[model samples]
Target: MVERRRFSRIIYQAPATIRQGGTVVEANIQDLSLHGLLLSTDGNNAELNCDILADIEFTLPSSDIVISLVANLIGIQKNIIHASIDHIDIESIAHIKRLVELNVGNDDLLHRELEHLSDLGEHLSDMGEQL
Candidate 1:
């Protein structure tokens, strides 16, 4: 497969719950990037173009993280759901970026990604403060 993604992706399996309004579905994330994730479910038929709210849980070297983000359903190939992050917090985004840095194994690329994290734009919310 050709790598057409702007940011590099890494295989990451994590437990996740995807919710759209009252409907909820469980899935395991197969691949991840700072921008989005590809998840797989048994027989979920999530609608395309709908906004999905997800809580993805994973463990890193030190701490366990639960990343809560809102994403739009971009595509679905059989059981795979390709969702793009539409909203997240700064801390969560930074942690995800750090995880990617750990997997990417390139010092210069990590440094550059650190710089790019600040430019992820206004989609990041202050919802953490409310919680």
Candidate 2:
């Protein structure tokens, strides 16, 4: 298959909790990117569903700063879950950007990805306005 990812993914493991409605499940982040994350749980969380919105909270490794964001559960395969970020606060986004920047090791590439993300957001906002 062709790769369509616009953001660079970095392998960073961290414990995360996903909360949807009244259900909460613990998962380990397998990898992270600016736009999405891959999580691994012991088993498929039957309570979570694809296309549902959820809140994911996790702290940076060796740091007390908590990064929390709203994401959409887009896919699940056995023990792995895929979530696409839908909304994130300023502080969390800043932390995430710095984490990604450190891992990517290329400031220009990281800036390009940020630009793409910003463009996508603007396009989505325009679509929302039209609708």
Candidate 3:
């Protein structure tokens, strides 16, 4: 029963730094999507609605292009923070997308297709329960 609209989540562990104002805090990126990212940090100081800047360093699988993206933190839950890339950060995502398109095999497509099938099944199940 995943509540998120984006069901296709690729888990990746990478070092991240969240800079709020002048203070910088270290964290880890647990999951990623085109929309937002899940961050695991130590302290609970990352508030629900606090916006912070994140410097993420991660390597694309099988590629030597280790990229760092500066993103904006959008929300927090428990010790995990969620962030969405601002408009200016689209280029970075675009670069990643291109890399995935070039390198990824049929597995990525299969997973995305399975996610849609699961959503359909869930919708039908909900309708059955309602009836």
Best model number under lDDT: 2
- Taking all chains together, the TM-score of candidate 1 against the true structure is 0.74
User: TM-scores for all candidates?
Assistant: 0.74, 0.96, 0.55
Off by over 4 Å in 3: 1-4, 44-72, 88-91, 98-131
lDDT of 3 by residue, 36-126 (tens): 5788888844433364465555665666756567667677767888776543245566665554344445567746745664576588789
- lDDT measured at residue 39 in model 2 versus the true structure, 0 to 100: 97
Model 1: per-residue lDDT, tens digit, 1-131?
98676677888887677777666778888888888899998877554334445444444434566677778778777788888887778888888887788899987876765556446552254454455
**Each prediction's whole-model lDDT (CA):** 0.72, 0.93, 0.62
Provide the global lDDT of candidate 2 against the true structure.
Answer: 0.93
**Over the stretch 41-83, how does candidate 2's per-residue lDDT look in tens digits?**
9994888977679999998878799999999999988889999
Model 2 lDDT-worst window of ten: 43-52
**TM-score comparison, 1 vs 3, better candidate:** 1
